[model samples]
Target: MEWLNKDVTIYDLINDHYRLSLWGLRCINIEKTWGLCDEKKLSEVIVGLIDSGVEAEHEDLNGNVIEGYNFIHNSRDTCDEFGHGTNVAGVIAAKKNNGVGIAGVADGVKIVPLKVVNKNGKAHIMDVVRAIYWAIENNVHIINLSMGVEVISSDEMNLVRLAHINALKVAISKAIENSIIIISSAGNNGEDSIDFPASLNSVIAVGSVGVHKVNDTFILEKSEFNNSGKKDIIYAPGEDIYTTFINNTYSHTKGTSIAAGFVTGIVAYMKLIDPKLNQEKAKELIFKSAHIISNHKEEIPFINADNIMISMWREKVNK
Candidate 1:
């Protein structure tokens, strides 16, 4: 019924009977945010998703997305062709309770869809840098980067790669200095190292945690493809995540990219609670409010969205 503006002729809607597949939200304790904080301030938060692009006219994301730029084509047409950005955007701010598709982690948040990657889902590092600068100029509160370059620990970096890396670092620093919260995927290499940008300073790197429920109990496992290290990285539900797709469709995906989306949404919600919540403070709060998932090598932090909101709210009230 509400598919008038969607690009596709036939749009998929989440039926009432089968609307409970959003286990990713449940894994992060997202429902505990009910009656939690200042709901009106949510609209003040804007997340700049630097990826392929977004289907702004999708049935579930129509009103939630705002004007953005496409670096590949050097045009204003930010419609998604690679489909990664749509999925990430849906995870962060898909319309909630409109009785259509699945609910996003955070509600009332607008997304600025910055298309950095091309139609093949490949992007030059300079394009990503440009996107970050654009987000700073637009005054976005949060930036979600679901893409990164893989690096081998033993490999030698050439001058060009090093220059690109430096450019990205400078751009990210500028964003952080402007009080923007940057969340990035911790790569999907399944190695002991995190990828660039995600591994860069002041960026909140997110890894994937596979969630399993058995006999009314929730179990968390580190995803095999998720990059982990001794660095301060947080985990989120990424395996078999259900989210909005291209052409106004809904489907399941899995990766550290999806996990980073969850962190982005939670960080946006935290920003709504405390406008002064910067990158350092957000990382501190996320680490503090997280549920620990440990193994023999390390203790990973699985974010708890409810705890983050409650903590920020309490800080505001006590002040």
Candidate 2:
């Protein structure tokens, strides 16, 4: 919610926007990362970007996007309407160094776009559940969820209602059982809290942070809209981050949504380094290689993809 330039500032990072986007990638250390996995294995490593939709035909994303389903309209195509999914997708894997827009954290990986939300940016738990099952069936290595309940409630509800929420949780568990990493936004409400699926135990909840304009500093300070709480796991630069948008343009947006995308990208990078990486090991490496923010009462760490890649690459050599 730290929407400094809500209207104008929150535009796409296209038309040579990579120059402005270098900071976030540099912070994560993905600015210069170009790791490699086996071509055959890389082709099989699909990363699911679940949200409203994706502009799959966009110049930067078209090549890597594989067959994706639209649970919203029950269609085979997953073109974006609300623009969130496409933005998130670009952040995670927007065809790197294409002499166009910015590069995603895991530019080389294939993306599986799952359109769960409609044009209004709304998605039901049922569709979300279905999307997870779809991603699992398609053998996705990672599932990035940038949408979820605004808040979770403890009040007792009807059996049918509770069952729906439970069903989504169950799908998350099944994904974990399959060794798939599930990453979600911690919400952008700037509270000591987490949204529904993000609050779930198996999901890696990512919070948002703002980068100092001049000093280039880092901290786990919650964005005005970024939800926080004991359930928080990782923090990433989310405010006014530049990324791909609809119509092959670029824009800047804020929220834990983008933060979740950053972590998703990091997780994908970890997998690229080791195709057999499990959820726990991927999380461990991300947490261990992050920028530990001290003096912040809570011990949540911020992701530093650069350090992570260096350590991982070194380990790869020793192995």
TM-score: which candidate is best?
1
Put down candidate 1 lDDT per residue, 145-165, tens digits, no spaces: 999887644257888888888
Candidate whose lDDT is highest? 1
lDDT values, one for every candidate = 0.83, 0.77
Superposed model 1: Cα runs more than 4 Å off: 1-18, 152-155, 212-218, 294-298
Residue 180, model 1, lDDT? 97
Model 1 C-alpha lDDT versus the unseen true structure = 0.83
State, as a TM-score between 0 and 1, how close model 1 is to the true structure.
Answer: 0.90
